[model samples]
Target: MFFLKDLPTRQMLQTYHERYPGMNAEAVAEALRLLRRGSLLMRALEAYFTAHTLSQTRFLVLIVIDREPGQEGLLASAIADRLDISRPVVTETVKALVQAGLLGSVPAPGDGRAKRLTLTLAGRAVLADLLPGYFALIADFMAREGDGTA
Candidate 1:
């Protein structure tokens, strides 16, 4: 996360530019603002997920499976590959979901050692309950990008 909540002022960057020849103050300032905004938006999403009783990782895992078509599910490794999160984190999240009765797992047909992960009925129920609000939140965030409200 971008920890610096307040971006450096243009004047400050310009002053620094005198010391560092290559410092493009305007470009750097714009980039910093963009990063700060992105961080804020990420925090908003995390807050929304937390309010709905899900962590970002858990929510991602659910959505990845939900987006897949058919009764057959996806493998844990496949999930790890599809997401930016690490394998160990994904594995732990899947385990927690399974224990919570929000996810189900079955052995792959050809590969008995690999498990195919799918959403349980409770998982679908949770997604169905939360997705509408989630979409609205995302829509609002995206809308700000075009209107300069962000």
Candidate 2:
């Protein structure tokens, strides 16, 4: 199933097992290596969010809210605007985070129909704890990718 090249990328090489006898183990090994790197990325991102009492989407919503133009944040609808996703998506994400105490919502005080968002202190602490592991996984990933040391 390889394209362009005679050999598959490490990730692709993993698909073949019993059919190809005498296949290069090196290819399989390299695929394993790349898979590990990919896994590290997910683990890092996941750990960063989870440690902060957030899911991946919730962390993204927080980042968007924190960096919004006013630095004061936005309504659930406005957060949806920043997300490039649907209103319902933002609504759901915010609802869960609010329940977890990682996020809070206050009325816009202007629109009356809108709710703004903020992160709680416990949420910040969780983010702080997660950052180091995230950084380490990233460093490990970059080291493996940028150099042939692995």
Worst 10 residues of 1 by lDDT: 141-150
Could you tell me the lDDT of residue 114 within candidate 2? 82
The lowest-lDDT stretch of 10 consecutive residues in candidate 2 is 1-10
Model 1 regions lying over 4 Å from their true place: 142-150
For model 1, how does the per-residue alpha-carbon lDDT over 1-150 read when each residue is reduced to its tens digit?
897977787778988999998988877887887787788788988999899889888988999999988879899998998899888998899999999999999889998789989999999999998889888988988787553234
In order, candidate lDDTs are: 0.87, 0.69
Superposition error at 62 for model 1 (Å): 0.8
Candidate 2 residue lDDT tens string, 1-150 = 122223356555545544576678686666655666566567667776666556667777877765656646677876777777888888898898888887778887878778878777765665666657767867876876674335
Residue pairs in collision within model 1:
none
Report the Cα RMSD per candidate.
Answer: 2.1, 7.5
